[model samples]
Target: MDLFDAINQRHSYRGPLLADPVPRTDLRRIIQAGLQAPSGRNAQTTEFIIIDDPVLLAKLQAMHPANQAMQQAPAMIACLIDRQPAAVYEGYNFQIEDCAAAVENMLLAITALGYASVWIDGWLRLEQRADRVAQLLMLPTDKKLQILLPIGRPAEHWPQKERKPFAQRAWFNCYGAEETPCQ
Candidate 1:
């Protein structure tokens, strides 16, 4: 598929995901796309924990309170970053931003490959929970969990969501200034 089609077709599939396993080659390609994302100061801190093992997936599902759909996913990706490199930031760490960009790229690539995916954000901010997940994944001591993404083929229909007009959400040089209206 073309880039435009991928962007337009991408959506957070929340219903059910097919049980068919995602090929490791495809997963590697998706992760490679993520790695292509830009990094701050060339730190290249983004790390990916691609989990296709059913037992491990179940372990991660147990971490959630009531996310049954997680088990339906054939595979999931845990986006992470090594803080040792990110710590070089003077005040703020851009690891989260960098990893998030990588995740978005992966999501787009998943869509392009005729697959479905959803962003799992809350998993990264829970109290001591993310730390446990990191340990479970055997991540490096300096690595920190950022986000998770469950990917698979869609088992249910997912229609495109409505979006606001460009004029309302866009500005030329400042917020609240409608510089370019949708035509």
Candidate 2:
């Protein structure tokens, strides 16, 4: 798919996924897209762990008792950020921003590559799930699991959610002052 199409199609897929496994090669490509994302001060504080093992998948699945997508995804990517990231520029650690950029890139890549995934961050934040996942993956104390993406072929289809008009959300010269903004 082209870049625009990927951007348009990339949505949070919370539905069940097909049982077919996602190839390691594709997973690598997806993660590579994330790695290419621009980081604040080029700190590049985000790291990733790709998981495809059935045993481990089962363990992760158990964490999300209500999310079918989490249970059925054939693969997953864990975004890790430094727990105590050193300030790279302006005494600011951009791990969170870097991680978000990376996740968005990966989500687009996932759409472009004919796979689907959901950004599973909030759920991970609940119930100390991120900590558990970090422990499960044997991450170092410096690293914390910041995001999780469940990857697989979607079992069901859903319409892309509508987005608000550009005119309402954006403006040419100032904030929300466009009587008629050019597209």
Candidate 3:
């Protein structure tokens, strides 16, 4: 699919997913897209662990029992982030920004590949779920699980989410300015 189409089609797929496993090749392609994302100061703080094993998937499903998408997804991607990342721009680290960029890229890729996924962050933030996930993955202490994406084919179709009009959400030269700017 075209980039714009993928971007338009990409939604947080919270519905149940099919049981079919996402091929490793497609997973690699998705991750490659994420790797190609521009990191803040090129810190490239994002790392990934693709989970396709049924046992691990089952464990994750149990962890998020209330979420049908999490339970039915045939595969998942865990995005790991560096805690004490070297400040590449100023004195502050941009690990979160880097991870977000990478995730967006991967989401687009997933949509293009005919797969569906949801950016699962808020749920993981509650009750130390992310820490437990990191432990299950045997991730290093320095690497924290910042994001999780459950991926598979959707069992049902969902409508594209409505986007705000450009005039309301964006402007030209100045904040809240008209798109064309002064003549």
Provide C-alpha RMSD values for all models, in order.
Answer: 3.1, 2.2, 1.4
> Could you tell me every candidate's TM-score relative to the true structure?
0.87, 0.96, 0.96
**1-183 per-residue lDDT for model 2 (tens digits):** 999999999898899899999999999999999999999988788999999999999999988978888989899999999998899887878889999999999999999998989989888888888999998999998899999999999989876899998977977766777676545
Q: Write the per-residue lDDT of candidate 3 for residues 1-183, one digit (tens) a residue.
A: 999999899999989898888999999999999999998878788999999999998999999987888989999999999877887876888889999999999999999999999999999899999999998999999988999999999999997889999889877788888756755
- Model 2, poorest ten-residue lDDT window? 174-183
Query: Relative to the unseen true structure, what is the C-alpha lDDT of residue 105 in candidate 2, on a scale of 0 to 100?
Result: 97
Q: Is candidate 1 or candidate 2 better by TM-score?
A: 2
Give the clash count for model 3: 0
TM-score of 1: 0.87
Go through the candidates in order and give the clash count of each.
Answer: 0, 0, 0
lDDT of 2: 0.91
Candidate 1: regions farther than 4 A off: 84-92, 178-183
